[model samples]
Target chain A: MKPVFTRPRSLADVSTHYCPGCTHGIVHRLIAEAIDELDIAERTIGVAPVGCAVLAYNYFNVDFQEAAHGRAPAVATGIKRALPDRVVFTYQGDGDLASIGTAEIVHAANRGEAITVIYVNNAIYGMTGGQMAPTTLAGQKTTTSPFGRDVEVCGYPIRMAELLATLVAPRYIARVAVNSPAHIQQAKRAIKRAFEVQVNDHGFALVEVLSTCPTNWGLPPKKALAWLEENMIPYYPLGEFKVPKEAE
Target chain B: MAKGKVVINEDRCKGCELCTTVCPHKILALDPKKINKLGYHPVTLTDPEECIGCALCARMCPDCVIEVYRE
Candidate 1:
């Protein structure tokens, strides 16, 4: 009998520790599926970041390096430089990417490093208990802002994909969500293309996935997805932020 | 003979409530129910029979819920 869907070989058999409704599992599956499809699971190296996804090292079957908060890009840079022939990517969350690791990501993309960056943006800092992140929307209530995120003091949420696209180094940048199955399909396409850019040595590739943080958002898994539609999508606006002509 | 009911893995919903907003028939609603383990109220379909199978709700849902089928 043929199975409709089975877990990807690139992912370990261990159950994930992520809270119910968190999109980390979907993102991981996408990455693993891409790696498996590209036939590069053996040659791929992933850099995991601090925050909820830190244990990503254990999730993916490929070799992984645990990096300090916001340092995955720098570490991935080193790994890709040392093994230029292998596929190297960094999986990071908003707290690690747009907040503490902003400099690293900007410079790495500025340098046009040959690596893929899978950035998960769920607005609030997830693993750290829903503190307001740099990507948290105005009026969004996080642990840091129980009432709401006051733009006067907190400033506005940063659109990392658009910001990164402005730099010339990145060859591909797109923001897709996993809130729905259709969105998931689109996200998978984007992830595959990002990897293709790296495998083809097309400089930097970044896929900013608008994911859900049910635990931190104080919503159930289902409503959190709807919230992304109601709030997150309008602010972030999904679609290809940037893509090199050659890759297209 | 009937097709499978749209299986909603409620555990995976993020409670964004976009599904309710997109339902043309307004069959779905974000009830004022208490929070789940994740701490947000989840959406509940009030009248499943009224669903038109437009799938607008499914397409609009960011968390990948709302499966549709023929009964």
Candidate 2:
């Protein structure tokens, strides 16, 4: 028998510490698959974020650097600049990217750095016991916002993909989900393209993946996927918000 | 029908049961009788004959515990 679907070579052969049904594992697998498909495992250097995936380096076989809370983009920028030959990327969560590391991400994209960013937006902060994050939807109940997020006071959830797409320096910006098989496949393509944009020296690229926080959301893994489709997708519509002019 | 087989890394599974929902043949289920070191019911192929090797279960699995093969 031919093995058709197995673990990606870029992924490590150990169990992850993610909670039962956490979609971080899925996103990690997707990134590893992209690295494997691109054959850039040897030259790939990933910057791990401070949120739940702080230990992301242990899951992938590529060289990794640990960045301070919300400093992944800055770290990645330094790495990419120092070693222009290496393929640099950052894996960050909503709290790291949209909240604490907001300045870092905005400047990194605005500066047109030749780096790939895997931004995982699960809305609430997962690593810190489900506190409200900048990307948390309005009226969403979180530990920090027990009465639900009030748009009047908290403002609306920041659509990172759309925000970055508005910048002229970015070569590509996409928003995808991993709630189902179809979306997961599309997410893989987007991630691969983000890396391709860097490989071609096209400038900065970011793929904001709408992920699930089953434990934080107080829902089972299966229902979390459904909830994301029904709740998150409408607010943050899925699609490539920006692409290189030549590819458009 | 295309013949397919699925292998589960029993220890690696977090027993999220996400794969059980996406299986087209519905051949996957949590084994209530057995628990892994993680203290969770590991997923098992309930009926291997019903599996069409679609790999949907593997794709949906968060932990990458399922591997699919085709004959």
Candidate 3:
């Protein structure tokens, strides 16, 4: 019998530090598979973020650079500018991308940086033990907001995919979830499209993935996925918010 | 009418049941009596003949521990 499913070549043959039930592992596989399928693993440079996926550099079998918290875009910009022939992508979580890195991400998108960003939004801060993040739902309960997030005081959750799509420089921007098999397939397609934008020499491209944080969300691996489907999907609508006309 | 199998890297499994939840066949279960290197129960196929090699479990596994094979 032939093996139908195995680990991708672009992924390192080792274990990841992600918590059990965390979809970060799935997202990593998706990105690695894209790189392998495109045959760009040799030239791809990933900028690692300072969150749950901080050690992503160790998982992917490509050249990697470490960026400060919320500075992946800036770091990626430098890398792309210095080495235009290389493929550059940033892996960032909601806390790293939406909060401290907000300004950096917006400016990078506005400046039309030629890079791809794999944005993982698990609502709460998983690496930091369930703290409220910028993308956390208004009524969600986190360690910092034990009483549930109050929109009046904390402000509403930011819809990043919609917010970034308003910019004209972005060649592609999409939001997808990976709770179920169907969504996982869709998420992989979106990731491939994000990379294609860069391969075609297009401007900024970002794929926002709504991931599950079972440990931080206080749910079992299975229930957390269900919670994401039922609660997170409604608020963070999924789709390609922006796509270049020719590619659309 | 198809036969399949699931090969698990028991040492790598973190005992996350994401794959078990998505198995339409309901043939995957964490071995209660067996513990892997990680101290967590590793998921295993309860009945090899029941596997359809759908690969949904492999897709859902965060650790990439499950590999599906078919004839």
Candidate 4:
């Protein structure tokens, strides 16, 4: 019989620590599938960060290394340098990548490391209880910013992909979303392409996925998805931020 | 009246069984017999004739392999 659904081999069978309704699981599956489709699972090495996805190393079946908060890019750089033939990537959240790890990612991209970075942006910090993250939109309320993020004091959100695009070293950079089925499909394509870029050794490739943190957002799973579409997508519209024509 | 077809992209299937686990109408099930390219037993629409086009399968497939069309 033809199969319609099943687990991707790229992901381990361990239970994820993510909250129910969080799209982290969905995004994880997409990355795993891309790895499998590209036949790079054996050659893939991942750096798991310190945010909600800190425990992601346990979920992916491939070799994974744990990195300090916002230091995944540096860790990935080291691993890629040690095993240049292997496909090296990092899985990071908005807080870990956009905030503390900002310098690491910027420098790695600037140096043109042959690596892939999957940046998950759910606006707030999920592991630490919905605190205001660097990507949190102005006027958006978080645990720290209960009255909403104030542009006057808290400042505006940082578009990490756009920032990375300004650098000349990155070969490919795209921002995708996983809010709806169609969008999820599109995101998988983008993710696969990101891996393809790394497999082809096309310098730094980053795929920023606009995901949902329903538990932190204090919304139901369905509503959280809708909120992502209504708010986040508009703020970070999906597109190829920077793609080298030869890599395309 | 007949319902529309269910399409599964073989490469996209991860064999998570979330779709089979969530189908309230119980129209989907793992073959427990077949192995896909990724070498896992994937889910099969057990009784395609009984499907209601609910789309629960499509929603649950984390790999996005299930595509449902209502006729």
User: Could you report the DockQ of all the candidates, in the order they appear?
Assistant: 0.11, 0.88, 0.87, 0.10
Residue B45's lDDT within candidate 2 is 94
Which candidate comes out best when scored by DockQ? 2
For every model in order, what is the number of clashing pairs? 26, 0, 0, 7
* Stretches of candidate 2 exceeding 4 Å from the true structure: none
**What's the DockQ of model 4?**
0.10
| Residue-level lDDT tens digits of model 2 in A1-248 | 78989999999988999999999999999999999999999999999999999999999999999999999999999999999889999999999999999999999999999999999999999988999999999999999999999999999999999999999999999999999999999999999999999998658999999999999999999999999999999999999999998998
Better of 3 and 4 by lDDT: 3
Writing each residue's lDDT as its tens digit, candidate 4 over A138-238 gives 89989999999998997899999999999989988999988776777888888888888888855789999999887788886657878999999999999
RMSD after Cα superposition, model 4: 6.9
| Tens digit of per-residue lDDT, candidate 3, span B1-71 | 55778899999999898999899899999999999888899888898788889899999998899888888
Q: What CAPRI grade goes to candidate 3?
A: high
Q: Per-residue lDDT for B36 in model 2?
A: 97
- Runs in model 1 deviating more than 4 A are B1-71
The best candidate in terms of lDDT: 2
Give the DockQ (C-alpha) for candidate 3: 0.87
Give lDDT for model 2.
Answer: 0.94
